[model samples]
Structure formats: C-alpha cells, structure tokens
Target: MKPLHRLLALALAVSMPGGVALAADLRVMTSGGFTAAYQRLGPQFAAASDNTLSTVLGPSMGKAPQAIPNRLQRGEPADVVIMVGYALDELIRQGKVAADSRVELADSRIGLVVRAGEPKPDISTTAALKKTLLAARSVAYSDSASGVYVERQLFEKLGIQAQLAPRGTMIERIPVASVVAKGDYQVGLQQVAELLPVPGVTFAGKLPEDVQSVTRFAAGIPTGAQHPAEARQLLDYLASPQVQGTVQATGLDSVPR
Candidate 1:
C-alpha cells in the first residue's frame, strides 16, 4: 500500500476497538534504533487495546548502564524487549528470553549527519564517503553495532584505519547526531532511525551500500515476564505490516514477512 493509504488504514485501526481480551500493563525495553516507530505505534496499540505501556530506552549492546542486556541482567521489570536481533538472540542463548517469542520488526541502516545549517557532505558513493571522512576534522559514530562496524571493520575495509584513527570517536549512550549537532564532531554516523530524530543536525545520507551496516531490530518476550500474553500482542503489533508506513517514516525499512 502507498504511504497515505497505510497511514489511513492504521488510523482506522487505531480508532476501532482492539481485539485483546483484557487490559494489561506492559513494560517495554527498546533500544534507540527502533524507538521512534515504537513510540509512535505503541500508543496506538495501547489506546486501541486499553493497555498501558511503560517504556525504557537503551542501547542494543555496549557496556553502557542502560544497555538492554544489562537492564535484563539486572532483572529490570519488562514484558517485552526490542533491540538489535543478535543482541536479542544473545538473551535467548543466555536463557533470559524465550527463543519462540522472537519477532523481526525492521532493518535499520547507518547514515551520516552534520550539525544543522552545515553543508551536507557527499556520501553518494564509497569513494565519496571515504573522501568525506578523510576531510573531516573529527568523525563520530555510535558505540553500538553500526559504530562497531565502522570502527572495527569499515575503516579497515576502506584501508584508512591508520589515517582516520586519531580523529574518530565512539559516542556512547546517546545519539551520534546529538554530538554532531553540538559541534563536538564534524560528522557523525549511526543508525538512520537514531539519526533522523535528533534536532540541529542535517542528514547527509546513508553510507555506500557496500559499507552500510544494517541492524535488524527484533523483539522478544523475556523469561519471567509478568505479562506474557500482553507482550505477544505488542510484538504482533510491532511486526505487523499494517503499520509499516509509520515504520518507514522513522527511517526503518520493514523486514520482509
């Protein structure tokens, strides 16, 4: 369906009564990459179903105190978790989450940002992206998956690891664009969904296809969840094609069903 049609469909759905049998309170722990869409769609589900949501925002990985895994390891109360697919799988492997509860929600690609009002740099091709990096006074990336790829693999892939080493930074527990917007860095790279929401930054465009890091955002019900059935209802809502236009609007591409 077209964007408009999808939005209208979702609107109609939200306006109608929901199918869940009873109202429940759901605790959701979601990482930054998928937060935008979740924030938008979550309330729709809640309003339609008469459930209430308590959301906690965090990263999919890294040692940050608010990282989703750390939150889970600490036994934070949560019914469902939305994060990078691999991270959710790690939770499953650790027996913190149920493998059968997993559902793929979206794929988020890495993109560039410069402080708002600054000229957007060229990242139209691999060579152009490299050139922009080389010319940058300082480059910032997240401490999450996309940054891991850029810091540990992409520079080596571009064969500029040594040259870019001194000027690169790994931003933690916050949006890369936030730093770029504050003039702390000349350019920043992070999941496109994470980048587009921050103010005072201009999106430069995604990295070249060959170098792009696309993280799959998936959700799962954690073991010992107090509201398993309600969590499944939310998981179904998030992964549903019915609200995909809102997902794309948040810079996430819907995963193929």
Candidate 2:
C-alpha cells in the first residue's frame, strides 16, 4: 500500500460513524504473531466503521486445527486472514484467497524468552546463543515461521543441530513463552511480538543477525469471504498511519514504506 493511499483510507475511516456504513460483522483469522495488535485495534475499527469483528487466533502454518490455513480449508467462516506473506501467497495460488486483496501489514523477528526469574541466558552473539542452547535442559521453539527457521537453519548454522536435537522440542499451536514460563522448557524461541504477551516470561532479546529470520505478515480477504468490502475497510484501517504506532507497540515493525 502506498502512503497516499493509506492516508486516503485513514481519511475515509475518520469520516465514517461506527456501525453506520458497515453493519455486518467480519470474521478474521490471524496468526499468533499479529494477534495482539488485532485485539487492540479491532475495537477501534469497529467503532469507526460500525463493523464488528469476530477474530479467531491461530498459526500461519502447521497441522494444528487452529492454524489459519487449516481452518480455511475446513470451511471456517473467515472474512480476512492476517498471516505470513508467503503463506497468503500460497493461498492465492490455491484459489482460496484474493491475490489482489493482499495487503502487507508488518514484519516481525525471532526472539528468545525464559521463565520469569530464571537467569537470562546470554545470546549477544552467535557463539553465546550456541552455548546457551547447548546448556538448556529443554529448549522449545514455535511450530510456525520462527520455529521452522530455528529447527531447520539456526541450529545447523551454529553447527550444533545434531547435539541439540535430544533436548530441543517444536512447540505446536501454543505460545513457546507460555510453556517456558510453566517450566516445560528452560528456553523458548518465537517471534518477538508473539512472546511479549505471554505472562511469566522475560524477553531475552532477538537472535543475532547471523541467525535471525524476519517474517512479513500480510492480510487478504478469503475468496469466500462473507464480507469482502468490510474486510478491505478493516485492512486499510490497520495499515493506516494512525495504526502503525499500535502495531509497533505490539512488537511488530509496520510494513516498510
């Protein structure tokens, strides 16, 4: 979306009265990484556009029932899907989503977390992160994009994938930080934004640049959307400059201009 277009959308949003122009409720499916922002911004959009939001939270990928793509495949009612850009692209190719409706929302990077009060592990460098992973009794990563990178590339890049396999686990459909907080794992890895909302955990910081992965989140209306027009309004509002602050405050970097 261009800056001028975003401003136009913002202007339109500001001009409308909530529940006047849009009276139908919209069903939204969003990945965990972007859920927090949606939760906070959904109400605002509803008030401004008069559209109600019924949001379903899930991952962008994985076999889990809650994964966005899986729900869509099973005939769930989703007016809009906010998820990984590449995953949205795949849905477009599969004829499940409207390619022309895709809108990039934000980007997120991987971060580490530990149970609250635990000695925060040092991950200031590639060597330090490798050492920390080796020492943890149980290490967990999300089953989504960040997890895939940690499982497939980060460990291998550190040359300790074989050594860490015995203790490392891929956390499925659950927040890695929450599990770590409960002591299921000593260290948890996930998108930084996704980890911040989990209670009883301390953010350790992002992965070193040498081993970091950034996931771009985008929104698109489903081909079968019940409220495609309303969905587009919500997407535009989300990408408007007014909402970028909330997006960043929730741990994501707004889409690059």
Candidate 3:
C-alpha cells in the first residue's frame, strides 16, 4: 500500500478501538539504527492505540557495558526490545525474551561516512576500501554489530587488520557517524540507517556487496513484560505493511513477513 493509504488505514484502525485499553503504557528498548522509524511511527501508534511509549537507546553489542543485554541483565524494565536478531535470540535462549514473540523488522547494511563537504573516499571494492582504511588518519566504527564486523572480520577479509588496528576507533554504545560528523574521527563506519540521521556527515556508500554485512533487526517481547499483549500489539503495528515505507525512509529495508 502507498504511504498515504497506510496512514489512513492506521488512523482508522486506531480510531476503532478493540483489544487492550489505550491507558496502558509500554516501555521499549531499541538500537540506534531503527530509532528513526520508531520516532516517526511511534507517535502514530500512540495516537491510535491511546498508549504511550517510553524508549531506551543502546547498542546491540560490544563492551560498552550498556548494551541491550547488559541493560536487561541489570533488570531494566522493558516490554519490547528491537535490536539485532542474534542479540534478541541470545536473550530468548537465556529466557529473558519470548522466543515465539520474535518478529523480524528490517535489514541494515554497513556504510561509510565522512565529515560533510570533505572529499568522499573510494570504497567501491574490497581493495579500495582496504586502502582507504589503511590510509585514514582516524577511523571510527560502532561498538555494535557493524563495528564487530569491521573489527573482527572486514579487516581480516581485506588482509589489513594489523595496519588498521592502531588507529581504528571503536565508538562504544554511541553512534559512530555522529563522532565523524563532529570531526572527532576522519571516517566512520556503521549501519547505513544509523549514518543517515546524523548531521554533518556525507554517506560514502555501503561496503561492496561481497563484504557487506546486512544485519537483520528484530523485535521481541520480554518475558517479564508488564504488558505482553499490548507489547505484541505494538510489535504488530511496527511490522505492519503500511509502515514499510517509513522503514525504508529511515535507511532500512523492511523484511517481508
């Protein structure tokens, strides 16, 4: 459906209330990459469901000590979590989230970012990317999924791990593109969606097809959720076909349910 049609349909669906009362409040924990879509769709969900959303932002991995799992381990209250699929799967295995409640939302690919107006470097191929990395005065990547790939896999694949490590910066629990936008780092690598939202940065492009890691972002209800049913409703709303455009607009490719 077109975006306008989807919006109208959603408005109508919410206007004709059915299940759970709108008075229920929901707490959601989501990674940075999907926040743009959540921010756009959240208000509409609230208007329709008559419920409020409380969101927490954090990375999906690394040693930030505040990644989603760490937050959940610390007993942070959340009804739903939107993060890298594998991370959510780990939570499900640990019995922190409902296995059956998992819903795949979108696919994200790693991209490069440079300070706005700076000369964009070539990353059109694995070799060019390797050279770019080797020459960058300072390079930053997230402490999240993309960073893990850049740190543990990409360099090895490019045969330049040793050369890049000394100057490679792992941005812990924060958006790598944001730091690059501030000129704190000469180049930044992170999910395309996460890079698009930050100001003062120009996206160089996704890593070459062969080397790209397209991370799947999914959502699940927490086992200890205060409002599991309502959380499911919110998840349904998020994964609804009508919002696929919103997902794509945020630099993610919506997963077909």
Best by lDDT: 1
Q: Each candidate's root-mean-square deviation in Å? A: 3.9, 3.9, 2.8
Candidate 1 structure quality by residue, lDDT tens digits, 1-257: 54634453455455445822566899999999999999998888777666799999999999999999999888799999999999899999999999999999999999999999998799999999999999999999998899999999999988899988999999999999989999999999899999999999999898899988789999999998998977887888788777899999999999987
lDDT of 3 by residue, 72-150 (tens): 9999999999999998899999999999999998999999999999999999998889888888999999888898899
- Model 1 superposed RMSD (Cα): 3.9
Quote the positional error of residue 246 for candidate 2 in Å.
1.0
Q: Provide the clash count, candidate 1.
A: 0
Tell me the TM-score of each prediction against the true structure. 0.92, 0.92, 0.92
lDDT of candidate model 1 versus the reference: 0.89
Model 2: clashing residue pairs? 18-50, 19-50
Expressed as tens digits, the lDDT of each residue in 143-180 for candidate 2 is 99999989999999999989988989999998999899
What would you estimate as the lDDT of candidate 2? 0.88
Give candidate 1 regions above 4 Å deviation.
1-20
Clashing residue pairs in all predictions, respectively, total 0, 2, 0
